[model samples]
Target chain A: MISNKQILLLTSLLIFSAASILFSLLSGSVDITLAEIAGSILSAETNLNSQVLHQIRIPRIQAAFVTGGLLALSGAIMQVLLRNPLADPYILGISGGAAVGALSAILLGASGFWLSNAAFAGALFSIFLVFGIANKFGDWSVTRLLLTGVVVSAGWGAVINILLTTSSTNNVQSMLFWLMGDLSQSRVNLAHYLLLIAGLAGGLLLSRSLNVFIRGELLAVSLGVNVQALRLLLFFSASVFTATAVTIAGSVGFVGLIVPHMLRLLGARDHRFLIPSCILLGGSFLVLADSLARTIVAPQQLPVGVVTAVIGVPAFILILRSTIRK
Target chain B: MATLHIQSLTLEVAKKTLCRDLNLQIQQNESWCLLGRNGAGKTTLLHSLIKQRVIDEGSVLLDGTDIADLKQRELARKIGILFQQGIEALPATVFETVMLGRHPHLQSLLLDNEKDIEIAEQALAVFELDSLKARPVDTLSGGELQRLALALLLAQAPEIFLLDEPSNHLDVAFQIKLLTVLTDKVREASASLIMATHDINLASRFCDNIILLLEGGEALVGKCSDVLTEENLSKAYGCPIQSVHSGEHRLFYPA
Candidate 1:
């Protein structure tokens, strides 16, 4: 049973997330009022303000929330899977691999959906490569897995540099935009939201097993968990989540590394509560960050990753200090 | 009736031979101690018996069936193990951590039910961990952590127990206290124990059988008195050991 304190904290985060979404909808470079946004939703009108709200802000905000949520959840799983605090969704090189696939597709004259699909394929390929190397001796050790992923990520980094170097200047600009993470370019697709929700539910379902896993391999196996299978599932799940988020917003960093630790500080270490809480906190955090990104510079629009990294670093340090003090 | 039979088992770890052509049978109600020096492969051999480590040759039969054929969950239900060391920290309270012992018995992945809670609380009360129940595992001292791990193993209540130095970090009184619980389990004849340890006195006092594991995968296996001879103990330990007998009690000390 969840404690009263946990319920209170979760409910508060929900309110904050909802407030951020509303804030994102109402406040942007385009001065869309709350009334206009609400009227557009209620009446399905197509005026200028309503058009901006429905056509751009809504999808962008929703997608930002989802991508952020996905990254944070994936990071939490990675930390547990490898039993390393420094682990993040990108540590296994899924994002690096996705970036390679995406940049290569752009180089090959692929645009829009095709590029994203190629990115996912690349992420899947990295997942298989890491697993193959880690499971070579039939022992999927966390240390070995971590080492394999880090090396693969480095390999992907070299490939990405090669692609960037050889590509034309025209493609370089778009490639850089993708590399820095841009949620504004993502279409308002229901599939992304649906996939995010499904993955979160699956992760929460696996939370108890995760709790045992985070404790260590010996305890997990002694408790009858199939550690190898669970490890594989966690790796793939995190990779898939990373693939989707990277496809949507290039590679939003810091959110994955920061948000889950913040939630842990908030006493949401249990995976059942932790995964769901990450969705709320991470989604709200990104929505707020994206709003600041577009408005803080007034129409120039900094990359969402830059905004997240800027805000997330300070917030994480503060939380870390508070946790240490406690 | 529950028996663990090792048939011509060969095991190796890190290019070191742990056991070669090893055959042994341990039945319910028999308490055995695996005595060995460091790197003697006691840990590796115990792991091999539980099928946690891959065997070079032969099979371990649980009751009448090969352990390889048994499902993981089924094996967990039949066997419980305690590691020498625990996670440096866990986010759970002692109550929550110990309650995890109900994991294998749990009908599903949900947290403890009424019965599991009852078992956990009973174990806590028996082990006298009430004061520390609400504390996080990291706050526990060495002895406390060992007791907590032991309590978790007891609450699991499997048919077989394979403990790797379960007494490490435990205070002398608590050591005897926990060992008495294992002795009681032996009396009930519902579970068997195979404990690896360096304490020959404790083994001589409690074990029905003793196995002295020497270097290079050779083991002197027999009853406590038979295998506790000065010659075998000295040879296995690579040290001169003399057995001093006082009344019915036997103690071996360095000569």
Candidate 2:
């Protein structure tokens, strides 16, 4: 049954998300006044402020929010799928594959659309590679999948290092920006929003089975959950989410690894609540972090990934310590 | 009421035969205990009965339906199993853990209804875990965890119960009390139970039938009194066993 406390927490998160998005819209290299924002909304004027708001800030915010939601949602599912609390979206080498693809495209003089396509293709390739190898005998255990993913990720890491060393200096800066997850050039299409919504809905639908699964696989099977089917579904869904997020923002870290843990530590362990909450909280957290990244230096931007790590590590440590003290 | 039938069941692990051509017929309201030493295949047999493991040969049927043909959810509504280990992975409140037993009965994308909540609550009360329902499962002691596991099975309310070492981590007094409550509940519902345990005395006291798995993949199954001879137990355990008459009950002890 849904509890009133969960409802209250979710409502608070929803409000917080809206407020963070508003703050992100308002804060940037060139500060747009509240009056100007209201004017831009109320009157469809093609002024400079309106142009910046519509063309630059709004798309970047949407990109950040959706990417954050996807990453956090994927992290939550990965934790359950691998039955490890430390599991993150990137643990299965999805981002590694995406990075390799994106970097290869960059080397070949591809940008934007083609870069994303390359990243997605590489992610899919890595996904199938891991799935194929781990499930070679048709009965892949969790440890096997984890080992294969980690080993494949290491392989990708080597490839990524090689690419970094071989690329021209002019291209390296942009490549680093993509790898560190820059929102300056990030944009969201309709498909990104759809994938985020689909991921959230799918997570909710499987929330009950996930709840049963965390206890143990044998217990899940005995309780009527088709463990094999559930594992397959989780693997693909989480992989797809990670892939999409990577293609959008090029591997934002910490949001995926910490947002879900923060929620769990706050007592949102129930997947029914955790899934949606991850979307709201993770999205807002990134929107706020990106805002800080944009205005922290003003005119010169910091990568959103750096900002997320800088903020996430200490906040998580504090939460962990307090939880332990309790 | 549901019956479990195992015909010519053969189970193996790592190319070693755990059991061969084992036939069993468990009728309604019957409680059977699997008594075997370590690696004698008690857990393997229970797993095979529930179709959790692939059998080398033969079939397991529930109410005349082959379990292999039934869906996991269908089988779950008719049969429940309490594993040997307690919850060690997830962090959840005791109440939430117990409520997971209702998972099989829930419709897709729907919440647990009031009836399901009531059943879970009643199971918590039965296990004397009402005070700890709000407490996190990871914080509970081993005995409390074991009791919670049993409570979850009660919430499942299946027609057949399969328990592996249900007495593990249970204190002496609570063990007797919980086992008594469990057996009484099974009898009241006219459901059958199959338990795998290492305690010969406990099995002798609680079960109506005995399945003693010996070395060489051979098994002796019959009424408790008929198959629980000193020789059979000694052979099954590969040890010298002695029995003592405790008024109306016969208890086994190693010599």
Query: Residue B48 of model 2: what lDDT?
Result: 74
* Candidate 1: segments with Cα more than 4 A from true spot: A107-110, A136-138, A165-170, B185-189
Model 2 stretches with alpha carbons more than 4 Å out: B107-110
Winning model by lDDT: 2
Put down candidate 2 lDDT per residue, A1-326, tens digits, no spaces: 67787888899999999999999989987779989998998998899999999998899899999999999999999999998888999999999999999999999999989998999999999999999999999899999999999999999999999999999997898889889988887899998899999988888888888888977898899899999899999999999999999998998899999999998887788889999999998899899999999999987899999999999999999999999898
RMSD vs true structure, all candidates: 2.3, 1.4
lDDT score, residue A243, model 2? 95
Query: What TM-score does each model's chain B reach against the true chain B?
Result: 0.95, 0.98
Give the per-residue lDDT digits (tens) of candidate 1, residues A1-326. Answer: 46787889889999999999998887787787777777889996688888888778988998899898889989998998888888999998888999999999999999888998888888888888988998899767788999999999999999999999999999998888888888878763778788788878888778877877777787778877778788888888888888889988898888898889999987887787898889888889999999988888886888888999999989888988988897
DockQ (Cα-based) for each candidate: 0.48, 0.74
i-RMS, every candidate? Answer: 2.1, 1.4
True contacts kept of 2: 0.80
